[model samples]
Target: MSGSSARFSGSTHLLCCLGAVSSTIVIAMPAGALARQAASPPTLNDPSFDAALPPLDSAAPQPAAPPVPVAPRAPAPDPELIQPLEPIGSADTTPPAPTAEQAGTGDATLRIRYETTVTGLAGFKTDAIEGDLGRQFRALSALIKDGNKAANAAQVKARADEDVQLAQRIMKAAGYYDGIASSTIDLVPGQPGVVRVTLSATPGPRYVLNTITVTGAPPEPTKIARDSLGLKAGQPVDAALIEGSEANVSLQLPQFGYPFAKLGDRDIALDDTVHNADYVLPIDAGAKSRFRNIQTTGDPVFTVSHLNVFPRYKPGDVYDSRLVEDIRQALVATSLFSTVSVEPVKTGVINPDGTEAVDLLVRQTKGPWHSLAATAGYSTGQGATATGSYTWRNLFSPEGALILTAVAGTQEQGGSVTFRRSDAGQRDRTFQTVLAIDNNRYAAYKADTADLSVSLSRTSTPIWQKRWTWSLGAEIVGTNEAGAALTLGGAQPRITYLVGAIPLLLGYDRSDSLLNPTKGFRITAKLSPETSLKGGKVSPYARTLLLATGYYPISPSLVLAARGQVGSIFGTSVDDLAPSRRLYSGGGGSVRGYGYQQLGPKDANNNPIGGRDQTEFAIEARYRFGNYGIVPFIDGGRVGESSTPGLSGMRYGAGIGGRFYTNFGPLRVDVATPIARKPGESVIALYIGIGQAF
Candidate 1:
């Protein structure tokens, strides 16, 4: 075969396959004829046949239909357009790094924003339920909690789906059992990549209570238990309220002498047609009981004998839960227990009055019963002091504590050992004995003193503040003190003195809090009568002090507080009294801007000589925001040479303070300056401590 003929045959075979023609006709011919035939390619009606073959001999090629315009092949989509998802089941469980889309590439539209709405509710419920739904739904919080990072479309849809279920639950809690919630996630119109999530809820009519009933409760406490529940017919059938009220049924019975009361599950019958429900609560209220024998259990620090004194109820006395709760609080105040419970347990014995007798059960779990604490404070005149204490709360058991305390400072150094019994023979009462020795160096005088004291007191704690409190005590003190001579330039000899005193105190507190009262008032009066033997000359004197403080809340976050104090000495001349016993003011606890004992009478050498009378007044405006507070305060005080406390030489201090509130109390920093500058006084005095200054 000729070369031209072979080319023609091969070309025809390739074109046929390329065009996918169903039929082909092949004829052998002379080389010249074949060439001529090939030059004029076979023409068919099929568009593919003509296009697949290159024109033979450009000159002789039939005019091809105007070249069908072909669009330029689109470039392979940039691999960076949509980030490829990371393969699953990888050994590395760490999430793949976010793409530019996820990171929101400087485009606000890329990050998903969501909104929540509650419909078909009025008054406060609309705003309240809307807020609740926002918090309940993950779709609403995820972007915020995650710093508004963009989520993939799939993830966004998944969160919206979950939010629908949460919204419905929220509505049910608000008494709308037939509420429906739906969520939609869609790209914002005309804004590509900007996804919007909407969580919508339509609350049907709220169900109301048709009848509220309680069963299995005895006559005496049945009324009380029902009253305590605070639920009534015609009230909205709120799930949260129902659950809370059910708990009150069991709680109220025990308080009313039904010590063995047990509440069972509640039953509710709903009528969808009327949108109301019938509710029933069953309780097991045991026999009416009176107080009888005392029982102690668990890891109790107190014996049955010692424990019996804590409860106010006596044998044959009707049982009361308030007394039981008081006993529990008293035990907790001892700081000796990790857990404590005081309950009445059935004794199974019937009294002559036909009432069952129940034993008082005290259960306790010991916690860390020993502690070591240290505190330090500083002021312009008082300098700085560091105090440390070691306390063994259960040293003698039964709420007895032994404390060893030491104070070391620039002006004073002392140590003391104390034994205290809490709930001593009576609730909220204490018996304490102290032995102390100190060497003090102040501008007024220098003394080396030893003291022994015994006191019986009813004191208040931060946890259990009492309305009335009192204390009576006796103390004997021996000291050798050196003071300025009677005459200028005379010998200053140290005097040795023995002092005995009977101290009494009475206090009434209407304040709501012990350390941080916002409303109410408190007043305390202290009196001490003493006899001092100095150089074999006996001098009898009486010392008295009165203190009062009040707090008023102007707003939820602002409090107005004021304090006043007065002190006096009688029955002895100031010259004959012990220097340390003399009335004096000025310190962090008195006049804030002055040094310790700086405001009293001064000697010829310009040193404070102390005085027989003192008076002080302070006022503060405390404003708090969240856990922080700011206080502006003013203080004024004076010391007198006579028994009468007056305004003569009244010194005033003013300052602002800052507070950081904590669970325990407010931590405060005060910066005070004397209103009228005095020679040898600091411009600014700083005081740092816990709780309020008052």
Candidate 2:
């Protein structure tokens, strides 16, 4: 029995040992199994315990064996609260998950290192990025941080290249190229992902003026040297200035009649220190001289002695084409000549003293002309009119001319005799005398008048490089009149007076042509103050007239023109004055759309009551078609007593006209409609004339 008990105890010990091993396996193995498989593994595969296994304890436990088999105590709760209950398989294998510290510490440390490296770049000064650079920096920084290292590097290189290109562009913009300053961009090394770039520029050499002198012989040396020298001491030497100076000097010589002067050569020196330059000009003043001889040829109607009447220059006179031109003008003014030409025959050789001799040759055209003209027109102020005139040009002598004109119908019935002499050799003057008589009756008023006048005038044109003409004259006048008075029974007295006066006239005209003035001014002033040493009572009479006009070219085919005129009569008895001395405005030449003399103060019978003073203004725009032109014009004017009329007593008119060009002049035809008039006045009228009104 003792031996039986020993074996039983041993068995009990064995059981205890088994239980401990099982416990350890369940505790440790479940944790690993859970990691491998989400559910608990199947029960361990071991030998099953049967009732027969109790044989070792059968002898000892036989007496105390309970009537019922002790129910197996529930397996101790699993040490791993959650374990894989399914069998392990190849699909369950997986890597161990990372701990929190490993992920957090590792990523944080990497970011810190990257930021530190970026911030530590030596040349990367944040303050240096002020405006656009600051924006670029922000963009670059964000790109680096976002793990775009390749793009960041590309952007950095591209920006560096752009900086270099911009610098080059600036240099080019400043007109500098092919210089050391435009070479390259240098990049300074820095921490990883950071760099600094700098651009250095080298400037080009500056040239200075070395020597400056006048290069060419100018017509007026003093004036040309003063105006044409383009360089000053210590100034920059520019090729353009040198060229311009040379050209200006060359051009200046021609005005002084030195057509052969030239700028021979020029030299310039550059100074590096002060950035200055100097220039030297070589001038060639060639051949100063005079006309050697004069020759004439052509269809000469006049002898050399007669042609000598228009001598341009005497022997040994300075050679001047302009003087020769004056001679040509004198010949043309004679009216005896139709065509004239004067030219200098240039000799090839220059004198030993650098002087030249030229020859003058004259050509002329003889003329014997007869002209017959007839005209018909209607006027509201003058009624219908017809005129015929006959002219014998260059009649008797080369200097003699005569004209006979006759007029009939409404405006006036008149006859005229005129004789003229041009280049009469009386101090280079033109002489003309006229005898005229006219009977004029007005449509507006029952006024009829007759007048006769004899006048002699002398016109002189001097050589002053200006277009000017002056005239002095004396005249005798007489008048007869018969007209109705304001009242029915009162008959206007027939009054007459004889007066003589000397008139002085001054005129300045500058235009491309007399017929069509494109760009210039014309001014005329006349003063007729009677002198006491005359035929009858000098009739204390004085008349003053002023006219000014301007033409502006808008284009080759368009022009703008303006004119103003004022006339006044003083020291005159109204009744004793000749009808021609009265001032009247309102006509094609005054206020365009108005009848002749119809715009001024009027009497009860609508007669243009003559006034002592008159003023008129006109503005016109003309469009040219070949040689002809069309014009639309506006005019304003007034006529009244010098003392009583005010500014409000003015009339205005606007109209359109056309100009046809002929060899003699431009013939103008205008049709105008009165814009403002009295109740009984006509609205439209027509005017025909030759040349500009002014």
Candidate 3:
């Protein structure tokens, strides 16, 4: 019984060992559901086991009994087969393993420090990434992991290279590359990619003018110094100034008769070391020649004696073309010729002394040409009007013009004749005589006046480009008046006053153009005091008037203009003063927005009341079109005691007008509407005239 127990124990131990091995395999290997197959009863089979009991020799050491096979293995399991499969345990599952490189030398606690340098960034505000270094590093690491280290480095390098190039370009653009600092870039390595770059700039060079010299035989060197040569010491150097100065010198030479003079050998040099520039100019005053004689031949209407009066050159006089021009002007001034010419005669030497003499020639236009013209138009105030004029141009010679005009109308009925003669060598100086008589009703007042005056007047040109003109004249004026109270019904007496005054006029005109002044200013001052020498009242009354106007071009074709006029009578009795001396404002020339003579104070009959002292203002906007124009305007004015015209005293009106261009000038037609009027007053009044209101 003891031996039986031992055998059983051995069998149990073998089964336990087998179980342990199975458990290990199950833990390490994959598992799945088991499949069942039909089982056959085991045949106590293997002959090898059955015949394995062989006798041992006495000399052979006895071996330990082998553990009894657990239920005797039926057949060794097929090498490819797994028996009794079971489910896998969680402990045996794990992720795929990493490669050797990623393990990083197998050092678990390694520390990496990284540095970064960025380049080729435009407007790289530090605030944009003040604390974002980690993000940049992560992006770089990803690039390495994606096997694009070389490509990414190239992209970074490209940007940095572009920035470097841009820096150079910017320096050159500013003209400072020669003085500024250079730039560079480099790369650094760490846990993340890094780079370093530097940019530096320096100041550029400055240039100064070292010398400036003028070399030319300028006309009247003193005058040239005063008019040209706008240079000074210690001024900034400029190449343009050299050219400008040369041109100025050339301009002055011609006025002095050196037409062939010219500037030559001009240059400007720049030196870097001294930071200076120099200018040099040379002038050549070629050959000089003088006019020896002058002669002319043409269709002549005047005799040789008449022609001799207009010679440009005289014996033993210096030759000057300007003098020839003066002589032409003199002949034209006589108003006796239509055309004139002066030519240099090269006649053979007279008296065998090589001295040349010249002959003068004069031409006069055919006379007896006459023109008679009449114009008719309608106006609200005048109802209807017609005017006739007769002109005798070049009556006896080209320089003579005679004019006769007559007007018959409900507002104005008058006639006049005038003859004028211009002087030689002068543009505005003229000798004129006039005989005029006018009978008209002006501003509800009636007056008949006659005047005969002879005068010589000269006009001076602008001063300092201020556009002011000065005129001085001497004249004798005579006057007579009748029907002074015919319209006022004896309220004002029928007084006849004759007086004379020596007048001096000062005028300024700043209009952009004489034909159409859209911008600038115009001012006129006239003072005429009576003198006893003319056998008139030394009434101690003097007249002074001032008128000013201003214009502004608001647009290419539109202009805004305004004007003001003020006048006062002093040193004379009101009765002795001529009606023409009376101050009147609201008229065609004064203001178009109001009816002619309809502005200012009114009379008891609701008609316009004229005044001796007047003030007026007007504003208008003019718009121009294809050879035509239109204007919308406003007018305001007052006439009464210069100081006491009260706020309610002024007259106001608004109107619009159209213009048409003619050979003579622009013709104007306008209609004005009064803003405030008495009961039964007309709503509008009309005016017709020529030229701008101002």
Candidate 4:
């Protein structure tokens, strides 16, 4: 047969997500399945991507280290062994662009079938092998998809030989030295340029790690890196772990002042009979170097004041790549730059004392960038509301901005202008001030308020990572409430009084993400002490609140989330406390089963009157399907007139909700009914908004 007529061969592997669980792998195959192979598949590790060559020497067996036991894992659903073909390895870049005629057709039609199976290796190891083999074949198949795949019969036969070589390499990589890969190809009877192919595998015994040897490393300094190698004897021989350790050895040197560090050699000795694999690594730690000055990209907008605040190391300090990264993060966090790169600039031309110079490159943001935000929310108590805000960035500096916000709803309608500044370096301490007027319709009363306030806050994350936030602020509040009705003392409504107040808040967050959390806990507490300065009103008072939220993931796609809150007011009667200042519950953020502020005691008019104390609790079980979530939740809340929070007469609400996850946040909609309804309260309520209810 001519070269063009012979069968061609290729190897490819991909993982397909069984029903779920394992990080799925996907494989593409021809309509007919795998055909013939070229040769023993090429070595598993492509030479171009492997470590600098000259394979290391093999040696006699050495004592092995104790093994680390890994927990068992459930097997993933079997993969899709066959599927319609999809383009792989990207479109081949080798040959000149294929003409339409050639484009419509590919090398003779081929298909791949995986018949590889094994036992004895349990849990992650078993699943790991399956994923690897799938990916390997996927790549091999991709190469054959190239326009230049053997065009002649004899050439195709040669391609088959290459396929054998590739499969052998993959088998070895899987610790299956004795395994075999086989393929059979046939010409389709009625289809021209089409071929039927079948590929199968026999994965043999799994090999375990025997020993590891490290050479060329300074004993004292390399101890930690050497000790922490995650691989252990008795562990399934995994090429990935060995490669990663080899890379780690190379990195450890540079981290400790070695500027031109290198991994000299890597050796893997495989023993077929004993089914054991041993690893050896050689390291080269180049000369130590000091760090010199930092040369910036010279964007003037990133003022020295901004740039100077983030330098962790000065000239003459030990060279640390980590410090360079810190500088990069600081620059990026300032939101002043659109791009940032911090790296060594002159290690090649080292200083007389062997010092390396570094550079911090940045690109400044331009223009008066603006963003608009819109919001719509609904609740059983407040009905529905809408809000809008516009923000201007880089108003005065990179970290300065102003926002204008307006809101109108059943409970409140108002507008405010806020100015913010946050240039306090890496900790992200910010200062903000706001001026506003609003009509607040509380369940207990209605309020007309005018307010001015400024606050400063800092959020910091560090090693041992407390992940806490701290803030302190003061405000001037004046309001008239209770429909200008009588007060607790039965006197005229408490109104027209200037109150000077200061607030201190402390918060800690450990959630993976702010908008939606799968795991972790967050807690926030605030204390506000106010003094009345208006004539005839000496109602000095203190308010305190504490809240905590927790998330526990039951599975990759399921979570259990909960929140609890408690609050109290002291040194003032419920009537003396402004409507907005009093504690209340029964809303989406509180007890969802009831109306907004509906859980607590009511006033003479059967209207919600703010309470001196409030408590709330909520629990939700959430299941996610890709980007969407379904949640069933239950809530309980209590309100009281006593200064101390009372749990009596607690109200309960339960409901189900749907969430559509998005880049910005999750869009949520829920329908709830009061577990124990009051005669006048509505029977059902619907709420819609963004982010988790909390």
Q: By lDDT, who's the top model here?
A: 1
Better of 1 and 4 by lDDT: 1
Off by over 4 Å in 3: 1-287, 290-295, 299-388, 391-402, 424-427, 459-493, 510-512, 531-540, 572-581, 643-648
Residues 1-694, model 3: lDDT tens digits: 1111111111011011111112244456668979999899888878888777666554578799999877855887786686655567635667556446437636322222122333333331111133322232224332223332233445544444444443433332222223333344455554244444454433244334566665665444434533565655444343334346556776665444334556666554545555455555556653332444334455554445444545545555433446666666665544344566554433444423333333333334533357788886656655566889997765545245688989888777878787755332344444556777777665545667676766565543221133656555444444343323434444544445555666678887767665457788889998776542223344546667788989898998898988887777655444445555555555566654455565555555555545567777888888889779898888887776443233447778788989886655567787777777656445776766655656
Q: Which candidate is the best by TM-score?
A: 1
The lDDT for every candidate, in the order shown, is 0.79, 0.59, 0.54, 0.69
Instruction: Rate residue 538 of model 3 by lDDT.
Output: 49
**Across residues 1-694, which tens digit of lDDT does each residue of candidate 2 receive?**
1111111111011111111112244444445444554787777555565533656644563366568767888888876876766665646677555457537655422321122121212221122233322233334543344442323345544544444444333332222222222122223356543334343443244244555665444545645654766666654343344556667766665445554555655554333444444455666656666656667798865556666676656755556556776777766655555777877666765655566776667887775467788877654565677889888877756566688989898658888887876556542556777777777776333323333333344433332223777787777655555432565444554445455677888888886666667899889999987522223544576888899999999998888999988888887654445545677887766777777777676655556667778788899888889778898888888887772334567777777888887776678887777665668666776777776654
Model 1 Cα shift for residue 33 (angstroms): 36
Q: Estimate each model's TM-score.
A: 0.80, 0.53, 0.49, 0.70
Give per-residue CA lDDT, model 1, range 1-694, as digits (tens): 1112111111011111112225478988876544443466765698887798877776464676798889999889877887977778755877676667656566534455543333333331422334444444443444334443344567666665665655666666666667776666666687765666766667777777888888887777778878988898988867667767767766777777787887776667666777777777777888888888878889857788887777776778777788888888877877888998987777789988778989877887888999999988777777789999999988887778999999999999999999998888777889999999999988788899999999999988888889999999999999999875666655456999899999999999999888788999999999999999998999999999999999999999999999999999999999899898998888788888887888877777677888898999999999999999999999999998899888888999999999999987898889999887978888998988888989
Q: On a 0 to 100 scale, what is the lDDT of residue 281 in model 3?
A: 54
Candidate 1: TM-score? 0.80
Instruction: State which candidate, 1 or 3, has the greater lDDT.
Output: 1
Clash total of candidate 1: 0
